[model samples]
Target: MKQFFRLMAALFLSLVLSLAGLAPPAAARGKAPERIPTILISIDGFRPDYISPALTPNLAAIAAKGVSGTMTPSFPTITFPNHWTLATGLRPDRHGVINGAMSDPAHPGVIFGKSSEQPWWWDGSGGPVHVEPIWVAAERAHIRSGIMFWPGSTTAIDGIRASDWQAYHADLPNHERAEVVLDWMRRPANIRPGLALLYFGDVDVNGHRHGPGSPETTAAIRDVDAAIGYLRRGLAGMHRQVNLVIVSDHGMAHTIPDHVIWLKDYVAKEDYALVSYGGILFINNVPGHEAKLAESLKKMPAFIHCWGKGELPERFHYGRNPRVPDWLCLPDPGARIMDGNPEHPNDGGDHGYDPASPDMRALFLATGPAFRSGTHLPVFDNVSIEPLLRRLIGLAPGKDRDGTVAPVEKALR
Candidate 1:
């Protein structure tokens, strides 16, 4: 009789402790209620139009339960720069990830995309340029983060790796990506990640090869949506609510081989390094040729619009960064620049244009416990995403952060 009484007393005490959250159940120990688990997915090259019900049923379903809207990419809407901007919430001018292919005078030989092997160019310590990523804010608050294939994740934050992250892997299948995320969530609560970023390149890849409107691109978008569904099922199996945000770095636009500009006609090869991305170019002029080169490039106004370092449009928040080349150009829609005879496919699509242009707008869709169902927001800037994530995860944002939640808070419950 005494033993039975003792067992009852112990059970009561356990219940009291658990109720107070002083002692979590074995299954939930060390997990934080204040820190929500969030999965941020970036589908490269997924334009807003790519999310129609006919093409992306899964995304539409998520939109029905969450907020969906157009998201404008930062200026010079290319991959690496805009992806980094999404992570840091700062424009390329501040983060110093100037373009897909760029040279930072501060970090000699450390190119942004091609020189990933160099740590100084990527890790936060690599600065004078590498800005603080939003993940670092989560980490400072004792939250663990996991990243799979998100740009800028490979670099260390304050000399420490993202709680865990992987270098880019082209061969990792979409299903495996979903399973990996599920596995991460299944870890013991103490070691489980509170934030995760997943990336898919298929939509962008198809857009570049087959053009954004091609049936092949349609098929790719559907495949990506299927992957999203796979991730949803996996998250549900965990029996825990997870916030999901799907975004794209930039949209895609059609391009034809005939619309190309050959640069060798106007300048010597050594005089400048021509970094072209569909409609944008970062021209690093040799010391003596800044003025002449800018002038020469301007002569082709029929094909490109050249701007001096300080001449970049204010809306872009670019050009001031030292990494910005001596000259910047935005080619006309459907145009591209090359050295002699560049070797890209005859026809496909590209994105590196003015962000305000319709072709440069990316997709934004999110669903989670803290958000209102069926919310649809007016078009918002991609810079606004960082604040939304910070708020959803129970963190106070820095006053100086580049994003504003006011525009997106309408979607919050």
Candidate 2:
């Protein structure tokens, strides 16, 4: 009789709750908060002016309905450094991937190339401290991430790798790369990645082989735009909304072979080790010849500017890292610093110039439910992208990052 009374009491309570409309809805119970996906795409070396309706109809359509603006790349305005900065929100000085090809004293006689995948080169596994990139942070927070063709993504940074990543293959066609990303997106929500990165090098490659304004470079731009269009159309077919951001590492500048700063004219090859020579030059003076090398560099023509490592302009925010060379040389626009080698020619196009140069400005565009439509944002730094990405993907602000979301908050809905 007592057991029967307990059951009756439970039924009575349920009935009362239903009458009062206090019972939880069947659809609402046990439901989790929705997670919005974010996709970041990089069109390497794409300039802001390259997004005309005729040249890049797909990109122009995105810009018309999304937030569009120019971004100032970090000091040197190179590929690897700025891309790492976009991922980590730290300057090259802090992240330590200083240039495409660079020397590190920690690994004696080892030069890191653009494709170097050693963990120590990126994560500072055996050297300076390591920084956590977006993928690593997302993975730690139980968010699945997919990285492709982003510099440093090939390595297991901070001992953590994204849920899925691909070793960069230059031969992979841009359209196929987009198709691969779409495949990842087609998975069920529980298995799909919350963050995905896509990259295209056709523009940068053509821009370097041909001048930025050449017909070949224009064809490359249109081709990349078509690939992006494919990705956009695929997302629409899936009936899903994702925060999409498109950017470029840096802009390209046309170069003339006649206006080159041949290093042999200024300093002897034996007097210093040429760490890097191109749009920007870095050299390590041999022991006891620092004074001689400095005096010789001072004689370089006015078109080139020379500075000791720590003496870089305050605006550059560089030179603190030990990987930086002892002597740094920056050539003026349209000029290049070369080693005067008959084999290596720099006649096409180059970057890594002064960040303040108009040619160094990069492209930025974003759109999604998280962003306001038809917003025209003012020029901003590329570092701010990390914070904006974190916000879109629901990650908390990182403590060590140098960027804040304030510059891009106006673009958010």
On the 0 to 100 scale, the lDDT of residue 313 in model 1 is 76
Superposition-based RMSD of candidate 1 using all C-alpha atoms, in angstroms? 5.6
Q: Per-residue lDDT for 21-128 in model 1, tens only?
A: 865568877645545599899999998887767778899888777888888898779888888778877777776677788776866765666436455444334334
TM agreement with the true structure for every prediction: 0.87, 0.93
For model 2, the local distance difference test gives 0.88
Worst 10 residues of 2 by lDDT: 121-130
For 67-186, candidate 2 gives per-residue lDDT tens digits of: 999999998789999998999888888888888888787788888997787777776444345677888989999999998888889888767899999999999999999998899899
Off by over 4 Å in 1: 1-35, 114-130, 268-270
RMSD of each: 5.6, 2.5
TM-score of 1: 0.87
